[model samples]
Target: MISKDTVKEIKILALHIRMETMKAIGNLGFGHIGGALSITDTIAALYGGAMKYDPKNPQWEQRDWLVCSKGHAGPAIYSALALKGFFPVEELLTLNKPGTNLPSHCDRNLTKGIDMTTGSLGQGASLAVGVALGHKLDGRDNFTYLILGDGEIQEGQVWEAVLFAAQKKLDHLITFVDYNKKQLDGYTKDINDVGDIKSKFEAFGWHGQEIDGSNVIEIIEAIENAKQHKDKPSVIVLHTIKGKGWAFAEQELFNHHMNISRDQMEEALTVLSAELEGLVKE
Candidate 1:
């Protein structure tokens, strides 16, 4: 079990991830806001607590791996990596710019800490399975974590990877489904409703559970449980609110990808700054 102080620290880290992600995308005036905000807490939990990685040695042989299937949420993971010293935090402002290492989608070749280049939705799942199986074959104990968007799961390849992971009994592989309910077009239900993601993973033979994605403590506990279950791969379905944290983005219906004016960006920064102040006081 994680200590209370550690939980508080992780929560602060999550807040930092949200603030940095907002700042990075706000610099561009627009990007994948909804999915990036939705996955901040989960990414924080992984990078701040669960995952064993070295920022100084990103290619450490024993370090764990992360494959972001919902690669559009790259900004959030980038924020975490930056805060953890994977690279200079100032580079976040250069997202998607000419000659910038930070592309709109994650590129392992370009980024220092990224394990795999991912942007094609369902493909990351398959790649994650391959990485996990390879680690197992090499007699390594490190876990390969995969984060998938709820909308991305509509692709058939995700199911194939799920089945293959279970068949191989890749117990060291842990997956998180960011079920934020909103995709780029609109709501997931309005686009393609994936009914009961937990049940689907369970039926596919994974040890699955559903949790509140924004709750840091729940995320830590769920990951701990997943680590304990050694007979099968584990999947956590995170029920989250898309465009979380920032008031304007959270309430906006079409916030999946948005053009943020100077005023809007200032408002978001103000709100997040106040949130950080409150957390630090606590």
Candidate 2:
């Protein structure tokens, strides 16, 4: 079981990721905030303690790898990486700028700790499966984590990868589906409903589970469960809200890719600051 103190730390880390992500995208004056913020908690859970990683040795052979299939959420990973010492925290503000290592999407060659580069939907799943199969064949126990956007699963390639992972019995490949209900065009349901995602994965021969993606404790515990299962790959459906942790963005239906005014960004930072203080004191 995770200690309460540890849970608090993870929670703080989640908030920090959200704040940093806002600052980074906000600095650009426009970026993928809604989708990015939705996965902050999951990223925090992974970087906080669920995943084994070394900031100084990012290429550590024993380390588990993360593939952000929904690559628009790169800022969230950048924020966590910076906070975990993968890079200077101040560099987060350089997101999407010229000559910046941090792009709007994740790129392994540019980023230090990113395992797989992704932007086009449904591709990360295949990359993650390949990595997991390779590690498993080498007798390595490190996990390959794949973070997929719910809407991205509409791609035929995603299901193809899902079938392949299950058939190979890549037990170490743990997948997270960000069911944020919104996508670029509009709400996922309105665009293309990937109905009953957990059921779909289970039918495809995966060990599937669902949980609150926003709660750090739940995310950590769910990951522990995913790690314990063997003989089949596991998929955790994370029910999340787009533009999560931000009061204004949460209410916007088309928050997928929206511009944040300077005033909105400052207000969000101020609110998060107080929330962080309260969490610390508690």
Best by lDDT: 2
* Model 1 agreement with the true structure over 136-165: per-residue lDDT tens digits: 999999999999999999999999999999
- Top-TM-score candidate index: 2
Candidate 1 at 273: error in angstroms? 1.0
Once fitted onto the true fold, the runs of candidate 2 whose alpha carbons sit more than 4 angstroms away are: none
Residue 62, model 1, lDDT: 93
List residue ranges in candidate 1 displaced over 4 A. none
**C-alpha positional error of residue 98 in candidate 1 after TM-score superposition, expressed in Å:** 0.3
> Whole-model Cα lDDT per candidate?
0.92, 0.94
Instruction: Evaluate model 1: give its lDDT.
Output: 0.92
Q: Write the per-residue lDDT of candidate 2 for residues 106-134, one digit (tens) a residue.
A: 99999989888999999999999999999
